[model samples]
Each structure stands twice: as C-alpha cells, then as structure tokens.
Target: MILVGAVVVLLCWLLGFWLLWHIPAPGEFRRRAGRAPAALAVPESIPLSVSVVIPARNEERNLPCLLQSLAEQTRKPDEVIVVDDHSEDATAAVAARLGARVVRAPDLPSGWMGKPWACWVGANAATGSLLVFLDADTTLSPEGLENLVAEYRVQGGMLSVQPYHVTLRAYEQVAAGLNITLMMGMNVFTPLGDRLAPSGAFGPCVVCSRADYFATGGHKAVRSAILEDSFLGRVFA
Candidate 1:
C-alpha cells in the first residue's frame, strides 16, 4: 500500500510538471529570438472609449486601492462602473465616493454566481466601446491600464491578465505551489504555446470590445459557471 501511494504521488507530480512545462511564459519567445521584452507600446491617442468595470461584494476596504490606481492611470478610463453585489459593507458608497458610477447588482438569479452576475450587470451599464472587467481587489500600476488597452488594440481578441502577487515576506512563499498550479492552467507559457489553442483566461482582469462581449453573450452566457474565466474564453473562442 505504501509503495502504491508513493507511485500515485510521483505520477501526480509528473503530470503537474508536464502541464506546467507545456505553457510558455510571457516574453519567452522574445528572449529566444534574441530580442528584449517589448515595452508598453500604447499610441499617443486611442480612439476607442474605454470603460473600467469592477465587480465587488463586501470589498469596501479593497475598493480604494484599485480605484486609486485607476485614478493614477496614464490613460484614464472614460467611465468607471462598480457593480455592488449585495455587500453587507459600504462598498457601493465607497465606490461612488471615489467617483465610480455604482450599479447595485440585482438579487442573484438562479444558477448565477455573484462575481459573474455582478460583471454582467456592469457590462450592460457600460457605454464604452472597449470594456475592461476587473475584480475589486486588483490594483494596477500607473501604466497598467494603458498597456492593456494597447494590447487589446493590437491583439483584437479577449485579453486576460493573471494577477501577479507581489510578496515581500518569506511567509508568502506558502502560495508558491498554488500560484504555479494556476499558471499551468493558463497554458500560455510553453515555447510552442502560441501554436496551440489557449486553454483559458485568467479571472482577475479581462478586456475585450463591447461588441464581441455581447456577441459572445458575455458573462450572461456563463451565468451558472464557477470557472467563468475559462467559460468566457470558450465563448470568445
């Protein structure tokens, strides 16, 4: 029994690593081609009106950080909408206070999770041509929104960014295993990743044209999905 258990654990580790090795890390190809990683190549003027939609549920404290980040963006969003998902806290008040247009998410319908439902509500209320769906807890760098918009203009597809956790303490290393596992699921790191169909989108930050979003049915189509990111990826695919 002990030998069998050892074999099972070994197989699981091997399988995990195999999956991990197949995904290409960002800028890997650039390095291989003897080129440096590309800088944020945003143009001087972006024609499309951009909307930053945040989905929040009891995130009053975290909202300020993300909202502040948005305020400091090099290219500011034309509009910011916060979908307050039935929070017990003052999420809506805080978002409105920060100049975000707050939309109170309706009572969750059957088979819908709070996050996706909130996202759907915000998307519908958004008036911009370009839509950026962000989680309440995500705080972007000064140029993050600009860089993302630039990528969307160039790539012309659903774009998702996985959150990069910045850890200064050794204790945060405890998340290393989970983080690596999550990255494996993204399937974009392997040397030949571009040749293969992408497996899924990350949940925290996603961008796309409003037309494509509605055409693919957006979060409304994945109302019941727990892994809304992966489902949204397929819908866009």
Candidate 2:
C-alpha cells in the first residue's frame, strides 16, 4: 500500500512539473511590436472604402483610448459607427464627442449575445466596402487600419489580427496568457484558408469585406451563437 501511494504522489508531481514547464511566460510572446508606417496608402485604382464599427457596453473608461487610436489612424475610415449596447454609462457621449456616429441599440434579442447583437446593429448602419469590428476596450495603433486594409484588399476575404492584449491585474494576466495559447494552438492563424474547419477570432479586431459579410448572412444568421466570431468564420468558409 505504501509503495502504491508513493508512486501516485510521484506521478502527480511529474504531471504538475510538465504543466508548469510548458506554460509560456508572458515575456515569451513578442509584445514589443513596432507601429506600422502611418501613411500606408492603398492603390488608387481599388478605392476601398472602410467603415469602422465599435461596440461599447459600459466602456466609458476605455472609450477614450480607442477613439484617440481611431483618430490617429493613417488611413481614415470613411465612416465610424459606435453602437452603444444598452450601456448605462456615458459611452454614447464619449463616442459622439470623438465624431463617431452613435447608434443606440435596442434591448438585446432573446437569442442573441451582447457583442454580436451590437455588431449587427453597426453593420446594418455601415456603408463601406470594408467593415471593421473593433471592441471598446481595444486601442489601435496609428497605422493599424492601413495595414489591415492592405492585407484585406490583397487577400480579399476575412482577416483578423492578434492584438497585444494588455492587462493590469494578476487574474487578467493569466487569462490573457491562456487566451493566447488557445488561439495559437487552435489553428486560428488561417481561419478561412486551406483548412475548411471552423475557428474563431478574438473579436477585438475582426476585418472583413462588406460583400463577404452579407454573403455569409452576416451576424443575423449567427444570432443564436454565443461565440459569433467562430460562427461567422465558418459561414464565410
């Protein structure tokens, strides 16, 4: 009995060691990304028009950074729409102050999740060839829009970026780290590429063509899905 107990403890210790050793530290990721050039001009022939959509839900604290980021983007979006998703805070005020067209979303539908429903409202109001869905908490670099547009125009399909997620608290740090690992491991790099399998984006920076969005039925088709980003990607595929 003693021998069996000893072996079990040893096995547990080994398992714990393996798990700890493989868990990537935050520093392992290349967080220090240089900002893309501010003036990344698209070819004049295409004349791609872009609509930037931001969904805010009680995000008064984070809205300023995002607005500033949008203002600084080298390739300005033709339209910027901010959908206040039943926010009790001053989200609409902040967005309107930044010159974004603020739309107040009605109460969420029974089957839809918060963010996706908000996105649905914004998408319906957008009038650009390209639609960019950004989260309220995310801050963009000055050239980020230009870079994404260049990639989307070239690729001509859905494109997403793994933005540098910043967190202040310890729990937030751990969650962010785990989220990164899951994304990298789940083969999300090419969600709509050669792999016909379904995958999801982080939802912070989802960029896709307006044509492709409607072709995939848009968020209305994925109303029931809690993870609408994954549903949209599969529908596009």
> How many clashes in each candidate?
6, 0
lDDT of 1: 0.84
Model 2 segments more than 4 A misplaced: 1-44, 188-198
Provide TM-scores for the models.
Answer: 0.82, 0.77
Leading candidate by TM-score = 1
Give per-residue CA lDDT, model 1, range 37-110, as digits (tens). 44322233657899999999999999999999999999999999999888999999999999999999999998
lDDT of 2: 0.75
Give lDDT tens digits, candidate 2, residues 1-237: 999999999997775454333332332212211224332233447778999999889988988999888889999889999999988889899889989999999998898888888999999899998999998888888988887787665445677665786778777777776665546443423323234353665567888878888878778888888877767766765
Residue pairs clashing, model 2: none
Highest lDDT: which candidate? Answer: 1
**lDDT (Cα, 0-100) at 85 in candidate 2:** 90
